[model samples]
Target: MVEEKSDRKKTNTIIFDASKKEPFNINEGYKILHRRLKNSWKVGANRDAIRQEILRTCDVFVLAGPRMKLQDSEIEALKEFVSGGGRLLVMLGDGGEKRFQTNVNTVLEEYGIMVNSDAVVRNVYHKYFHPKEAFINNGVLNRALLECAGKRVDSAQDKRNSQGLSLVYPYGATLNVSKSSVALLGTGTACFPLQRPICALNQRQNSGRIVVLGSCHMLSDLYIDKEENNKIQDIIFQLLTREDIKLNQIDAQDPDITDYTTVPDIGYLADRPFGCLEESEELPSDYMKLFELNLFKLDNVTLPAVLESYEELEIKHEPLGLIRPHFESPFPPLTPAVFPPQFRALKDPGLELFDLDEEFSSQMERLAQLTNKCTDEDLEYFILEAGEILGVFQNSSVKRQATAVLDHIFTQVCEFKKLNQD
Candidate 1:
């Protein structure tokens, strides 16, 4: 059977991927990934925010891009929300798109941050998210790079490996931050130039608490595995579940009232990690506010999930662990045979552009299989057509009118077939 995502209700991780469409079928596309990255409590009750709920329920949020670029209303809402104390979880995508980053960075710059998209930047100092078997500790990660690397490294690089600096663009960009801002991790091998830094931080002098992370792979469907073992996950855990900042640390003396907003009836919200506090007065009604909520595990051990009959998905002894299909039981034509053969040709060093990596080809082969509905042998030819298109473009050295056009076409086609299955 051709692989396709199902729209089933499951605990929320309602994603906002810059690369995919709205309301992704997280139950299947990202369910396993979520479980791996999540704390014990979020597993059972699908209490996650899909779209609106994501903004509403989260204390601090994480986002992957090539999908959700910033806009004016979104910026205004995010700023007010964070200034009111909204925690943000952010990452950078391919720094190869100027037009997309231009508008996105506009929203971010007002926050004291900026995004740069250009040239493929790569360097030895930069660490990739390799598989478990490939995990390694290469060097002492200057905490600055760690922000982009992750709180948890699947493998630690040897600290002795040291002393290197390089610049490469078109890879992933950096958040050129304002003076009030500081890098949580140290500088690394390559970073895209962000023309405006303080802008992404909402022009705030203290947006460090805002938590800006670079590197978008952390949450992608293909990259979530990296997050499973990322050192960044620890940072996320600390940021999200703990709602208290020591009350005694700030200057509480009778001063600086103009710059600060006050929460009137603050009482004991919790005692362990510190205390959760809120303005005893009514808060704004905006779904995009920055109010924080320290989530406790979904202690109600049961949750709902849909499953293909051949596979039995048992949960943590919870009755809610069953999936309801859109129309039928045992997803029809359940055979792996229909899936496409993900073939990878050995690289020909003779041709740089012709060197299609196994990863790229694997993705295209599967995407093409699904997009053709795995039924149209004629349209199925586009798989080869697309690869040839890349080959031809590289050979002729012609600039494109638009980037990602072919990607858009292919992805839309795949999505069409995925949703159209009846």
Candidate 2:
């Protein structure tokens, strides 16, 4: 019973690596994956350097979207771990190693799997909004994957059918797989880099296994539940942990994938254009042949023909004269009026409109006139006008009201009274 427990512990333990500052972890971006994994496996994170001691305790080690560079020792340790019946799962995002600033390819390339530095994008808009969320409708490269996903795999027709398993590969790149590895999934015809590998598996006889995925998001909380992705995840884990599921040797040998072809950047080529030189025609032995005499010479070759035509028609052959054209006037010509010219009188001087007495009046005289014009009913109006004439309202802080005007006047009177008493 104790041996069975130890075997169970060894079989179900999965260690997610975080020593390289990976983006996903148990308590963070991988919550859904953690929850799903907790039901059957013992999941945890490794925050220290990857060593054989730690790898010996777990059956599978997952490196999810690591953004930091791996040490040489760590790479060697992982290689040794995988060679000794251990499973290794490495997941990367779009832009691959250069974008992530890591040297994970040092380890992946050893197994004939290298994630390309290009992104996988959909050519048309589909259920997902982002173009990087490539929806591959027929990307199953190996029939073994379909069989493991509980899909019916017909040996004849369903190998490259449109009704195969689909996946939403978000923010992912493509993989360049070689003969040493088996391409399991690919970016189908609907995506850019058409029919290229996105997931690859490498297993040796009586040795460890390694699986490389182009997209780390496929098993994250955001996309793990998406179309057939959960099934794909199950298939990946099954391939790694279980030995009953075997890859089809025929499909593994020749995957339905196209070669990685690069297209020239049109914008770059347009910016730097090269001119082509053409071979000039051989010059003739005579230099006179280079210049054609009929190109620009003034000639009167038709003059004689014109004179014969005039004599044949019995017409006068004289120099043509210009005839004066008489244009009818639309209206009678205008003549100056037979009367003395009249000019507009200058406008009357504005001085007559202004009263000199009022214009040059002192403030006291204006106040006196305002007093005469107002009565008891205009007491508030009279004070306001008197204050304006005395410039009491010049200070903006003083309110323009009857009480304020009266207060100003009283304050000035009090100051004058105080001066007299002193």
For model 1, residues 189-218, the per-residue Cα lDDT tens digits are 232121212112221222223555444443
- In model 2, which residue pairs have backbone atoms overlapping below 3 Å? none
Number of the top-ranking candidate, with TM-score as the measure: 2
Residues 260-280, model 2: lDDT tens digits: 999887999999989999999
In model 1, the number of clashes is 63
Best-fitting candidate, scored by lDDT: 2
Model 1, C-alpha of 422: deviation from truth (Å): 62
Cα shift from native, residue 105, model 2 (Å)? 1.0
For each of the candidates, the C-alpha root-mean-square deviation to the true structure, in angstroms, is 37.7, 13.3
Poorest lDDT segment (10 consecutive residues) of candidate 1: 248-257
